[model samples]
Target: MAELPLADYARTLTGDIQTLAEAEDGSIPRTFTRWALEQLEESGFVSNMTVAYHSGHGVMVYGFGYSDDRSVLDLYTTAFSLDPMVDRLTKADVTRHYRRLLAFLQKAGSIRGNFDQPTEVHQLCEGVEKLLSNASKVRLFLFSNCESAARTQPEPTEFQGLPVEHHLWDLARLYRHQTSGAASEPIVVQFDPPINCLSVQSVEPNLSVTLAVVPGRHLAELYEEHRTRLLELNVRAFLQARSTVNRGIRLTLLNEPGRFLTYNNGITATATAAEFVEDAEGRRVGIRSLTGLQIVNGGQTTATLHHVFKRDKKDLDGVSVQMKLTLMGSDDLMAIVPSISRYSNTQNKVTLVDLSANDKFHVEFERVSRTLWAPPTTPGGPQTRWFYERARGSYAVEEAKQQTSIVARRKFKAENPAAQRFAKSDLAKFVNAWSGLPHLVSRGAQKSFAAFQANVKEQPPVIDADYCRRTIAMGILFKEVDKVAKAHDAGSHKALITAYTTARLCEETGRRIDLDRIWREQQVSDAIVQAAHDLCPLIMDMVIQEGKHVTEWAKSSKCWEEVSRIPWTVPEELAEELLARPVEFAVDTREEEEEQLSRLKQIELSEWEMLADWARETRALELAEQQIATTIAAKLATNATITAAQVRKALEVYDNAIEEGFSAFAP
Candidate 1:
């Protein structure tokens, strides 16, 4: 699809920001910054970000955070224009913004003492001072709602002897990022001197493998440049010397540099494309460049090498590590990379749940979201569905596909409003908060998602139609309470307030908030909103009284414990309306079971056969379970009557097959 014109896109974006700001009772810049940060976090451009706007004395910042490993520090600022027609941000404007952000970093120590009463800004300055003391690199980002007129980025410089990099995300750039439908902008690495490698021809088209030895110094430099982006596909983050493997890597790097190559299980990496240099006989000998390089395995070795090089000041002169590279096309990256990551890891265990977006639970949730029509808020009004974006850009992609017809696009938007769309991380946040995990929600999206996934792995939930409706209800409730928190105080830490308030409400009300009613009405009642408002300040006071950085304090389970201990009861009127017990919307078990069985029956017989064969081959099921699957497939082939018990057993076997890496036949 062709890109939208800059002016048109800007107007649309402004409309979105306005809608969001109005909903949250916030300003344009804060809303825009929060929105952009969500996108960046989703794309792995940043992680564990905290939105805290502070501007004064020729300094300004909207957010701050560290890389997952704390090797790089990031600060964010915005150059938003109220005028929708505004098209270009000049180089002078860009420089001023960059300098303002830099000044915040430079003067954090001095300005930290200026605030007599602790504020979010003061907390941010304190965080900056502490994190910067050991940071090896810093990044300053300027997010603008206008296209940048500057053609070239500022050269990398140093702040307090640490390297500083500048990045600008102008409107045009953000537009591409939203529509590109890729995880993140590709990371292209160019080698000054081509390195030798041995290539193996693969039978599969557009797939090749190669083996190469890379110098330890070069590996460290690459990690410094890319940070966690190189490990995007890897399930686990850098353990940072806590694990025996990392400690051993550090010890070897410091004690025996030469044997590092043999001692390490060489990294397994994937690239969208690779440039090769040929020898005199026309044989591919060296690799000159790699595009979209992602390390599927050996992230610990890579991270530990960089850690020793930077923190321990160990020499990497004789250190060399082997690497296995798989080259494929860009179209195949998402489809093929996760399998490689899941199987290649030798140092750590990677579970199916860690794959997250592709897990069966999410797939089932997405399916329910597509098929279930939410009741119209008013009689004779059009019904809509809450769009569950299981993948990053699925909503945009679906919207783009309808652009060929104006009516189709209009219908699509009416049915799936932009405000109703939520991503997987958003679901994680809402559910975690309601499940009395405000501390985990406070840890930011990626970490919270990791925690949520681990919990699900331990205690899996059935993702059914009723579950989907109730999940959307929780989202609606959280958002309404978010407005209450913002109206109480529009500054930083509103997310923490909303999370704690909802969690406390659940605790105080005994999880009897009538979610079925909320789902049917498509919003929370006035009493719940009032209850949230009543709890907001109390939660805020508890958070501030902890005498810790608000972000840091909110991340502690102890904070939740203290907040839960606060004496707050639901108002009498709200309590009288609360359900005696949580309501189950699916009242007709027979009909629900019939619906499920119908869905299973809709799957082709060949697909069921394929599933059975896979389960038998992988030994994912017990012998009895395998026989059950085979029986179901045979019954389907013969149009035989299948019992409800058999159907349940078939589903269990199917789920087991999915958990065992079977995806050839997904129902």
Candidate 2:
């Protein structure tokens, strides 16, 4: 939690990494790699394919798979020069790196190897071929922590006759993300000489709505430049949607070309700002730049355009499509952009929770937590503060304002439990850990998020005081276990420490201790803390023993994923092993929590009875019964058994009653 210079922080992080490397246990590097990849996955760089292993091809790490946008992803990560003066990455350096990797790609079919084979480069090559053959295009991403003075991009190349483009995720790019609290980089779209467009100011302040007819060539060119960055979070949904090629759109682009506008419903986009050049007569209509452009709608159309242009060598000179652009600068726009995207899509079925960064339920928790602080463990101890980041950039902004004292910033982070920094993905990881699904937990952030969203969709739990408190309590338990594990050091096996904390430590400790009661009391008991200190050492030993089966254990993402798969079942074999050993508690506390809740439910039922009776007895309720029943019936139809007649009756009288109440029943 200490606030050091940015360079110092990087040094410390990499220094710990160096120690992790020398320790040669594969825990630290594997753990750090997972954290960085998860951060990237959350930011929209990688998609469902997060698993990576060291290939020993002069590359530190490599992963090849399908990205969220349905593009072929061949990602390679390596450290860049930490020296501040090294401002630019040379083209020669990148070319040589790929050339070394090319040996594997050249013979993709010969890549059969065991899971932990040292020649994992062969598997990576096989992935590249699978993606290239099936995907519309292949993209290569190179990540580095070194700051680039300017945008240093890679030239496009070909693999097995498939189109491939290169993208650089350098340190300056990451620093910008750190300051802005953004996950993905903003894409700047320049429209030279003022294309055909119309602009109108929105009723909402600082928002402008514009409609423009963009040439197919220009659209294709933009996609070529930015690739999946333009798709935003919807990239996953876009890929998952029907793969039925838009044959009609493709044919039109290849054949008629001119009638493309009539056939296509143009894309709807959102941009942060618009730059315009005034005409000689000072007419402010010439647009020079469109910053932070994201294609919220019409993804399929744009992708189809690019695909046909490349595949069929179609002429796009006469092909143009309509585009609706929303320009807004308010931070609040981040919340609503997903809503706009959901409604604008005529093609795909979008899930509400998946569309936005975090839904209203998450934001409400942030709002509530900021108002209350958890009770300290000791009677007079300072209450542990809870900080919830509803927006990504707030933490950095808060730190910058406290520049005078590094201790003040460190105190802020210490007070704020790491678990309380719950974004949508973080919440998913927590819930999965508790749900007894170590496989889902091991699947990394995006997969965990999808699984969690699916769980919510199946049974929407009430996000009330108890739920929020318990969620925070779960976070407290996980973080506390982590602290205990780290303090023990476990021979610098931080990954094992992290893995055990989430997979076993939290689940076991949670089951044995009364978490709900602890949440209600607002503090962790020393009994649980001592239990973690006692249990972690044994768990670490088991993990280390399991890890010895593989060579280069700490070197690959696969090693961590493999370790994460170990069963964390309670009162089972592993639990029995631990219970047989000297430990603090050997009982499950959920039974006691359930007994208390059963009594509380009876009290709640009595309260509901009074409210139900009041509703039936009040004449005012009978007077508005038609409208109220209609509203209830409409909602009930979504998930409940309702007849067509009942639905029609509810709809038929509801509107007429409202109309009559306004005029016939007017006072």
Candidate 3:
């Protein structure tokens, strides 16, 4: 497929931004920043970014983030123009934005005290100061709506003795990223002195494997340069100090560096291409470079080694680790990479749901979405379908496929409008809110999807036509509530308000909010919209009154508990429209109870005793709940039969403990 011209793409992007801003009642800069960040995150360029726009005193910042291990800090800013025709960004413009971001870091201490009370800006300034204290490197990203005319980036400089790198993502670069159809920009690694390796035989024409022993120092340097990009395909984040595996690796590095190769299971990696050197006998013997390299397994080992090398200043002179590198073409990456990632980590605790984009549930849901059309709101209006993009950019791919004919493209879009398209994370957020998990939804897309995936794994819901209808209804309700929330306050805590409102509505109505009616009508009622507007302020007040960072507070389960306790009632008009949940939609309580009991019984008596003791020590549970935990532990010790009510109470206590920040596997 041919790429769109840069000028045309820019105009198209401008239209998209305008449409999004209008829908959310937000500013252009805010909408563009959010949209760009989402794209970057999906491409593995960034992760877990907190969007907090603050600008004043010759300083500006859209958001900030840090590496999972706190070794690298990221600050982002935007240079947006109102004119789509303005297509070039000068070097001076880039430097000015860089200085604005640097000024934020340099003056964070004094800027933090400028606010009388803690606000988002003040919290961000304080966070910057704290994260920088231990950071070894800082990255300043400048996102522009125009293309950069310069071909070279600014050289790396130092900030507070830490190296600072600059990255520019202009329109031309973003356009390529969107059209390239790759998950992330290809990473090209060149070896100064080529390392020796042995090629393995493979039956597939497009597949090749190489076995090599990589120096520990070289591996550490690579990790420091790429950070989490190397582990993007890995199932889990770096486990850090809490993981026993990491601890063992650390010990081996400290005491027995020479034995590291013998103790470690090594890493499995994949690449699009590998350059090899052949010996006199025409045998491939060494690797000179690798393109699009990604670590599919052994993330914990790689991260731990990097940590020890940087933080402890350990000498890796005798340390060496094994590597299995698989080479394949870009055409095979999307089809085969997930399987490689999934199978490589099978022996570990990684679940199939961790890489859930290709899961059967989502596949079935996408099938239903494509085949099932919503009833038209008007009697004679055209019926439309909700496009569920199972993968990122699938909607665009489908539209591009029909681009040979203008009429065909128009018909494709009219039947499945861009406004009605949703992605996996969107479905997770909508369903989680309706399922009484607004806290999880507020935790950000990656974590929220993880929680949602766990629930789906536990229950394994059947994705039928009825299920898809109800899911789409939840999406409609969320969008309606979001529109009302954003209209009232465009800049502050709109997501929280929308999520909490939907969850509260579900609780107050006892899960009888007439979702079927919403599905059939293809819109929310005015009464519910009004209810959302009325409830948003109260939710905001509750969230802010706690004097904590709004994002952090919303992630806490206590936030939901307190908001659920608020003395509010649904409007009478909406109350009359509520319908009892259909019998077909009801879960089998007996089966669910049995599952819960089975899971609880799997826990060891000692673990239960420890949980009870810790709960009492932390005061996480009330006296009655603490006593029940103790009773359950005792019963387990004696092999005594526990009643169904006790099992229910024990399960509640476990959940509450988790909410209180208790971790069963914390070191």
Candidate 4:
């Protein structure tokens, strides 16, 4: 086994031979440099590549990167050591130039994500790879680099110690537009990596609430589980260059959970909880480890905490973790935490453990759940509490020793394990039912949206949601469908699907939600809404037009466009059911063909003309039927007595009557 370094494994698999060898030395040869330039041709990475030469052999090149709107950043210098004008410069100056250029480049989207899979550049992201000894410390490795014009003489730009410029760019853009002529603006652009953003923060005291979490992704499997979205960065020099990476926002969450205290009026926060003596024999029970104080309110209803930053919800999984929550405070005040004595409504102890103020407690639970909601309207009539933390301290940090000191413990026989008989009063069941709402809706909507996509011939069908929203004049939602569908991020695509589904569902109920004017509500971002509205109508129009052309030969020419625009006159769902049967088009049946062929033979051209003339004349009482007595035309669909043969026979009768009159004249 190679037993390569953890990060280098990726570089070894997909990296170029020349690039990999010199990646340690931080240089690229001409051949690989040329390769890098061509890889990003279709990608919106570089605008133009130009080369200049000095003193006949010395060469210099400058790359200019532009944003979509064509705003220019400073020069992106690749390797100028070959250029004669810059060749005389000291190594120190070259390094400074590269660093300065990096800073400037980051001002745009100048982060090297993955050098290996050049094709997936826009679809991926790269971060740092750190192995911090934290309960939630993470390491992300997005391997990427860029090369200039020289084909065989360059190494991709890399980071041995640098700041993540893309995030910086995003932050700056977010701020620049938000502030209109604010004094806080900085003039000469200076990018210092790890720039700290300052804001006011407050920490509230420990409050009690019941919480339950369902296990999810393992921390180490962040990218493995979300490989579809993660941009695989070059891990080649990650170990040597770890200093240049940003693991993510760092913060500590302090938690101390106490019991819910109850009084006659209602339940409230507990100030303290009493501790119990250790008993090894008889009824065994497990107690919450060292609990006197808890963080958060007892009746925490509906709360959602997304990451403060736009960190991928999945990257959070990469955080290696050891969570810690502690219970430490005055023993006297702790008695108030689980006070069944003072707050019990009935004499039979207490249904819920009561809490008193001023008790400190802690837990070693990692908060990995994406968003937690504890609603007051819990289904089981129990309140729930939940929190989302960015970073947490190590649970192995001397917290295991504190586990012995717990408050009142619940006990039951092995035959009837207390866990087996948790009541509606228990906290676990309450949270499960309440917190499942969003996911439940999303899962259902996913199925419906997929079905619609399969049926729609258009590349991206207008979200059924947009249709409803448009009906109600919500122009923004009507517009966002297309944007989300083609977004580089799959999450965004899924979210777009969900949004469209919800909008459609809402419309089906006659909610009067206008999608065309969805911008009025401002529920979604402007870009997303515009993308949907602008793209959907064109797709619909195209599908309709194409359908018109295709079905023109099959349908009557005059009605072809109408048929195409309306597509199927019958409902789509019903069409499937109808198609399942064995079909027999009446026009194609052999029996019908024979009848049409036989009828054609009876109508001769002379007879046809003679019959036509007689029918036109009103004075032709001289037995017009006598002119066409041998006809054998088909009968009417509901022929009571009218057949082509009967008409001919009647004409013969008229001729006989005329003959009889002539004979009487001769007599």
TM-score of every model?
Answer: 0.83, 0.63, 0.79, 0.17
Clashing pairs in 1: none
- Candidates by TM-score, descending order: 1, 3, 2, 4
lDDT of each: 0.81, 0.57, 0.79, 0.25
* Candidate 1 local Cα displacement, residue 547, angstroms: 3.8
Higher-ranked by TM-score: 2 or 4 = 2
RMSD of 2: 11.0
How far is 252's C-alpha from truth in model 3 (Å)?
Answer: 1.4
Least well predicted 10-residue stretch by lDDT in candidate 3: 236-245
TM-score of 3: 0.79
Show model 3 residue runs off by greater than 4 Å: 1-3, 116-119, 238-245, 331-347, 353-360, 376-382, 401-415, 457-460, 487-493, 534-538, 541-553, 556-575, 582-667
Q: Pick the candidate with the highest TM-score.
A: 1
Off by over 4 Å in 4: 1-294, 298-492, 502-571, 574-667
Q: Cα deviation in Å at residue 105, candidate 4?
A: 9.7
Q: lDDT tens digits, residues 1-667, model 3?
A: 5445667567667776777778767778878888887777655566556667888888999988776566788999988877756657888889989999999998888888986443667767766787799899999998877888778889999997999999999987887777765666888988768888999868999799999888888898988888666776665642221112378899999999999999998899889888898999988899999999988888888888888889899868899989999998877765676677767774566653244456676887899878899898899999999999886656666766776887986797688876688887789899899988998787666656667766776677767788889999999999998887767652446677788888887777777788888999999988888778777777777866534656667778999999999888988888888875631353325567787889889988877888888888989889999998899999998989888789999989988888988776877
Q: What's the CA RMSD of model 1 in angstroms? A: 7.8
Candidate 4 weakest ten by summed lDDT: 234-243
lDDT of 1 at 613: 87
Give the alpha carbon lDDT tens digit for every residue of 502-600 in model 2: 556555544444556566566556666666666666656554453152212322345445544555444343343232322121223334445443443
Model 1 Cα lDDT, one tens digit per residue, 1-667 = 5455566567667777887788767778988999999888866787667788888989999989777566789999998887746457888989999999999998888888887445767777877887898788999988888888999889998998999999999988888887776667888988779888999889999999999988888888888887767776666752221212378888889999989888888789889988999989978899899999988788888888888888788769999989999999977776787688777776556763244467766888899879889899999999998999987767766776776887987898899877888998899888888789998888777666766776665566667877898889999999988888877763577888888888899888988998888999999998898888888888888986535767778888999999999988899879988999954433224545696699779877887889888777878778998898899999998989988888877887877777888786355
